[model samples]
Target: MKRRPRRSVPALLTALVLLAGCVLVTVVTVQLILGERPWISYDAVAATLHDLHWTDLLPAVAGGVLALLGLVLLLAAVLPGAATVLPLDGLFDSGAARGGYRSTLRAAAAGVDGVSAARVKLRTRRVKVRVETSRTQPDGLTDAVRAAVTDRLDRIGPATRPAVAVRVRAPRRTS
Candidate 1:
C-alpha cells in the first residue's frame, strides 16, 4: 500500500508564529498611537515602557511566544491525531528509523559479494526510510539491501516491507 506523507506540522507552526508576530506588531503599534492599554493602565504601560527602556522587547516577546508554540507543536507531533497538537515527533522518529535501517543495509551491502557500496532508504508502515549511496553499487544491490532490511526489521519488531524503498545507487567514477 502506498503511504501518505505526514503533514508538515513545523511549517504550520512557523506560519502561526508569523501570524502571532503580525498580531503583536499590530497590537503594539495601535497601543502606541491610540494611548490605549488593554491589559494594563495606559499611563502605567507608558511609564514602564519608557522607563525600562525595553523597546528591544518586541523581538524577545516574539521569540518567547514562538518558542512556546514550538514546544506545543513538538508535543503534538508525538501524539497522533492531536486536535490542537501536530504530530511532529513522528516525523523525527521516521527519519531516525529510516537512517538506522539505511546504515544497517549499507553494512550488509558492503558484505555482499561484488557490491562496492550501498545506499538504502527504508520506510516502514510506521515512518519514513530513505538511503542513497554514491559509491559503486553493483547489480542486484537493491534486492540485497531489501532482503537485509526485511530480515533485520523482522528480527527487531513488527514492520512492513512495502513501505521501505531500496534505491540502487550510482557507481563511483562513472565513465
Candidate 2:
C-alpha cells in the first residue's frame, strides 16, 4: 500500500460551488411559491439566452472557458499530492513523518565534534545536510557529518534509503 498526502482545496472549492448553487435555487423556489418577484429576472435571462447564438464569439469563448475550468478541476481531483511520510521497510503498513526524520538527522549531524549547526532537508531520494562550523580549516567535518547522518538513516530503516549529501560552510568573518 502506497501512502500519499491528498489536498483538500479542490474538494472544498467544489463543495462551496455546489452549496451556492443549491442556496440560489432554493431562494428562487421559495420566492416563486410565495408569489413574489425573484431576485433574478427570468425575462432578462430568457432574452439574453434568446439573443445569444451558438456561432457567436461570446458563446464560443464562454464555452471554452468553462471547458478549461472543468478540465482543471478534474485534473486536481485525480492527481496525488506530495507524500508527508516515508514508508518503512516492514511487513505491515508503517511510515515515519519527514519532519521526524529531518530532526533526527539534524541532531545526528550536529552531534559531530566540529559541526556547530546542522540543517537537514529530506527529499524524495536524497537527504541534504548543511553544517556550519567556526573552525577555519574544517577538513573532515563534511565526511563526519555525512557518516553520522547515514548511520542515523540506517537506524531509522526507511524503505528506500536516500543518498546523503553533506555540505560544510565556514563561519563568515565580520571584519
- TM, every model: 0.36, 0.78
List ranges where model 1 is wrong by over 4 Å.
1-46, 50-105, 119-137, 154-162, 172-175
Q: Candidate 2 residues 14-116, lDDT tens each?
A: 8899999999989988998999999887788899999999999999999999899899898887887657877888788888886787899999999999889
Against the hidden true structure, what lDDT does model 1 obtain? 0.55
lDDT of each: 0.55, 0.87
Model 1 pairs whose backbones collide:
76-86, 77-86, 77-87, 77-88, 77-89, 120-131, 121-130, 121-131, 122-129, 123-164
Single out the weakest 10-residue window by summed lDDT for candidate 2: 1-10
- Model 1 Cα lDDT, one tens digit per residue, 1-175: 1233465867676788889978977787788788776444567867866765445877579778979977887866675541221122222433224445446656765565555555554432432223345556456756766676666655544323344566555647666
Candidate 1: 10-residue stretch with minimal lDDT: 82-91
